[model samples]
Structures are given as structure tokens and as C-alpha cells.
Target: MEFFVEQNSVVRKIWGKSDTVLFIFAGASAEFALNKAVDWLYFTGKLPSDPLGRLFSTVSYARKIVFSSKDDANKAIDTMRKIHATVEENRGAVIPDWAYRDVLFMLIHYSIASYELLEKKLSDAEKEEVYNVFYRVGRRMGLKDLPISYTEWLPVRETHLQENLQKSHYTSDLFKQYKKHLGPIRFKVLIESQKLVVPSIVKKLLYFGVFSLLTPVIPMYKISRLIKLDWVLKSILLPSDYKAQINELDVHSD
Candidate 1:
């Protein structure tokens, strides 16, 4: 059975680990708040009301594609497209093509960024491989004007960063929702983690300081992982209600 991502792929290594996946969303949550089309997310009312549940729902679809057979992955992608189409129908406005591309680009960017921050830097070929997997998913969803190669995508991603993001009222409200949901301490950790993975533009727009408090603690966290005590730390840091789902994020092994 051919998998959507090959068994030996670095993409699996990146997404398989719980810490890496958490960081991916940490960066994405910041960018999601800052996106120009964030109102589209607010339209459904699901995102702001239950942001952590939304994170798990999004991660479920992503893992389904990454770990399943090709046919299953395609079905998951089609289901996502249908879900968005239903949302568009209910809202009576077409979501912009660029909005869709911005999301796809976020997955591609954060996948590499999160892994490198927690693990080692990905080589050029490995980064291309990462881009290709998500590119196929975008093609399945009919996203347009995506760059064909990872090298070509860099400038386009930068352009999207510049043209497609702003700090709107939606941004402020979403961050408030995050803080409300995660509480003060976890919220502070989320902000510091986002600082580690997000781009310079995101840092500028979010007014994040250059230094992350988590910087010195990463080595200690890595040691915890090696000693098999990482889950204990994760449980303490994350909310109690999602403990089971957080454990499930470690579904795949390298």
C-alpha cells in the first residue's frame, strides 16, 4: 500500500512527534490571527469559541493525509474541500483563492520551521520533499497559482506574508480568545513558542520581542524527550481536558 507520505519521509518525522506538531500550530495560531481573511474563520464561530478543539480537528485531517494510503489521503482532502464549500454556501460569499493559498503556505512553512527548531535543520532536498507533499494536497483542493518548487515558493511565500496579513480587530479578538482558552501561563508559553518558529514579518506584526524566554529551556526539553519524561511535561503545560488528544499526536514513530 503506497502511503501519501512515504514511510521513510522526513515529513513523517516532523509531523510524527507531539512537540513538533504543537510548535507548528503555535506558529500558525499567531499567523492565523494576523491573516487578512480571519473573518472567514470567525464566520463559522467554531474557531474563536473552541480554539483548542479546532486545533485538534485540523491536526486530525492533516495526520489522516500524512499517515494514510493515497486513496484515503485524497478522500480526506476532498472532505476538507467539501466542508469549506458548505461554509462558503452558508456565508453567501466566496472565500478568496488567496486565502486558501495562505493556509496551504502556512502548513508548508510551519512544518519545516517547527521541526528545525526542535530537531535539526532540514536539508534543501528534505525541505523540497516537505513542500511536495502539501503541494499535492493543495492541488487536490484546487488552490491556484502555487509555486511549483520549494525554491520558487520562497519569494511567493514572502509575498503572501507581505500582502495577505495585517493586525486587524479579528487579530486582537482571536488572541484574546486564545488567552481565555489557554489561561495566562499557557498563553505566555504559546507566545514564546510562536516567537521561536514564526517569520520575522510575523514577529514584527505581532510586536514580539527578539528573544524568546523558552530559548534556554529547549535543550532541557530535548533531554526530557530522550529520557521519556516529555509527556509529563506536556501534561503540565497543556490543559487537562485535551491530555488524551495530545498523547495521540505522537501516533507515528520515526
Candidate 2:
């Protein structure tokens, strides 16, 4: 069967690891908090109640599309579109176009950031492939004004970062929820990971010198995975309940 993303794509390799997935969500959590339209998520109350689970569900759907037949992948995309449309209808207003772009761009930027942090740098070709896969998803969802190529996407991504993010009460409350669920130490690590992946504008806005302390460990994570001691790091890093889901991230066929 034909597939939307190639079987051996870099996007598959990136999403196939649990650690990278967690980091992607960590960065997304930071941006999600800063998003002006974050209340759209709050309206459902899912993000506040169980942020990890909510993010994991998104990860799950993403993996499903990456691993499925082209037809099946399109079906999953359709399902996502219908879900968002239903939410908008129920709320009696459309989700903003820029807000939709923000979510899509977050995935694109963080996918590159998280993978490169844990793995080696991706070739420009691999980066283009990553953009292409998600660009297809954006098109299938009927999103307009998406960048025609990955090169064009860079400026648009930057523009979105500048025009779209800020610190608000939602930001504070969401971080509180992160701390409540992750405990203090892990939550700090989450924030540090956010620092590593977020755009420079966001980095300056949410400055903390403490995050630099975690920089040395990024390479160490790569080393541990190579030596099959990745579990030791995960045990120390990930919440126990989410360990299984991380393991499931490795389910893509070799």
C-alpha cells in the first residue's frame, strides 16, 4: 500500500523515539501556554486536566498517520479536521487561521529541534522531507496560505513566532498545571527543554540562566541511546506512568 510519509523517512525515525516525542510536547506546552487562543483548548478542559495525555493523544494520531497506508492516513487527517470543525461549531466561532498555523508550525519547528537535540543534525534534504510530510497534512486539512516549500516556510515560521506568542495568565496557570502533574524537578527540566527548542524571541521573553545547565546532557542522551542505556535516562527523566507510551513510540517497523 502507498503511504503518505515514506516508510524509511526521517520523520518516522524522529517520531519513533519516545524521548524526542516528550521533548516535542515539552516545547509545544510552552508555546501552547503563550498562544492567545489557548482558551480554545481550555474550553475543552482536556489540556488542564491531563496535559500529558492530551499531548500524547496528538502524538498518537501523528504516529498513526505516519505509519498508515495513504488512504488510512488521509482518513486520520479527515478525522482530525472534522474534530476541529465540530469544536469550532460548538464554540460558535471559527478557530483563527493564524492559530491553526501556529499549531502546525510548532510541530514542524519542534520536530526539527527535538530530533536534532537528541540525534545528530538532519541534512537539509531530511528537513525538507519533514516539512513536506506535514505540508501534505496541512493541505489535506484544507489550510490555506501554507508555504510552498520548506525554504519559504522559514520566514513564515519566524513571522508566526513574533506575531503570535506572549506571556499571559494562561501561561502562568498552564505552567502551574505542568508543575502539579510533573512535580517540581521534572517541571524545571520541562522548562529547560522548552528553552532549548523555542525560538529566540520566546527564549528572550522567558529567560532563565539555569537552563544552560541542561545543555551538556543533550549529547549524553545520544551516547546513552547508542550504548543501550537509554532506559536509564528515561527512568530518571520520564514520569513512570508515561513510560509505556514512550515504549510504544518505538513501534514503527524496522
Candidate 3:
């Protein structure tokens, strides 16, 4: 069977790990708080009700597209588009064009950022491959004004960071929800993890958050990995029930 994405692609290596997916959502959680369209999420009540569940649902769809045959991947993408359309119909208005682009951009940025953080930095070619996979998804979703290439996307990503985000009431409320759902400790870990992945601009804006407190742990994590004890150390940090689910995120190609 022909795959939609290559068996050994960077996209596969990145998304195949449950840890990377969590990090991706971790970075997204920071931005989602600041997004102007966030109230739309409040409309569904799903995010406030169960933020992790909503995030995992998105991760599952991403995995389905990455691991499936070409025909199945396309079908999965179509289902996502129809889901959005039905939401628009229910709301009696279209989702903003920029709002759509923001979600696409977040996926693009996090895919590259999360992988590099968990593994090693990607070469320019590998980064471009990451962009192209999600760029194809964005085009299929009919998103507008996406940059034509990864090189072009850099400044566009920066522009979106400047133009599309800000602190709002929604931001505070969402973080409170995250704290409520994750409890205070894991929520602190989430903030620290986002520090490692989010753009410098976001870090600047988050100047007084948990990142500083967690910086010392970085070298310790590296040392743990070198000694082959990182998995045990990191697993202790996560909720017990999620440990196996994370283990299952390893690469499995069609």
C-alpha cells in the first residue's frame, strides 16, 4: 500500500512519539490562550470541560493521517474539513481566515519545535519536509495566505506571532482551566515545556513564568538520557495512567 507520508519521514519520527505530541500541545496551549478566536472554543465548552481530551483528539487525527494509506489519509483530512464546516453552520458564520491560519501555523511550528526539543535539531531540508506535510493539509483545508515555502514561512510565522496573539481575559481563564484539569504541578511542567519550544517572542512575553524555575532541569534531563535513565525519570513526572499510552506513540508505519 502507498503511504500518504513516507515511512521514514521526519513527520513520522516526530508524531510517532507520544511525548512529542504532548509537547506540541503544550506549546499550542500557550498560544491558544492568546488567540483572539479562543472564545469560539469556549462556545463548544469542550476545551474548558476537558482540555487534555480535546488535545488528544487532535493528536489522534494527526496520527491517523501520518500512518494511513494515501486514500485513508485523504479521507481523514476530508472528515476534518467537514467537522469545521458543521461547526461553522452551527455558529451561523464562518471562522475567520486568520483564525484558520493561526491553527495551521501552530501545527507547523510545534511539529518542528517539539521534535527538535525531544530529539535533535533538524537540518533545513528536514524542516522543509515538515512544513510541506502540513502545508498540504492547510491547502486541502482551503486556508488562505500560507507562505509558499519554509523559507518564506519564517517571517510569516513571526508576523503571525506579532499580529495574531495577545493576553486577554480568555488567556487567563484558559490557563486557570488548564491548572484545574492538570492540577498545579503538571501545569507548571506544561508551562516550562512550552518555554523550551515556543518562539523567543512568546518567551519574552512570558518573562515571569515557570521557565526560569525549570531551567536547571534541562541539563539534568540530558544527563539522564545519556545514562539511559531518562525514560524512567520522565515517566515519573507524568500521570501513571498516561505512561503506557505515551509508550504506544512509537513509530508504526503502514
Highest TM-score scorer: 1
| Residue lDDT tens for model 1, 128-209 | 9999999999999999898899999999999999999999999999999999999999999999999999999999999999
Q: Per-residue lDDT for 1-254 in model 3, tens only?
A: 99888988989988876667878988988888788888877777888887777776777788888888988988998999898788889898888988888888888899998888768899999999988988888887888888989999999988889988888888888889888877788888888888888887777665635445556876687677669786886576776656666666754622
- lDDT-best of 1 and 2: 1
Winner by lDDT: 1
| TM-score of model number 2 | 0.95
Give the per-residue lDDT of model 2 (tens digit) for 165-214.
88888778888998999999888788888888877777766664535566
TM-score of 3: 0.90
TM-score of each: 0.98, 0.95, 0.90
TM-score sort, best first: 1, 2, 3
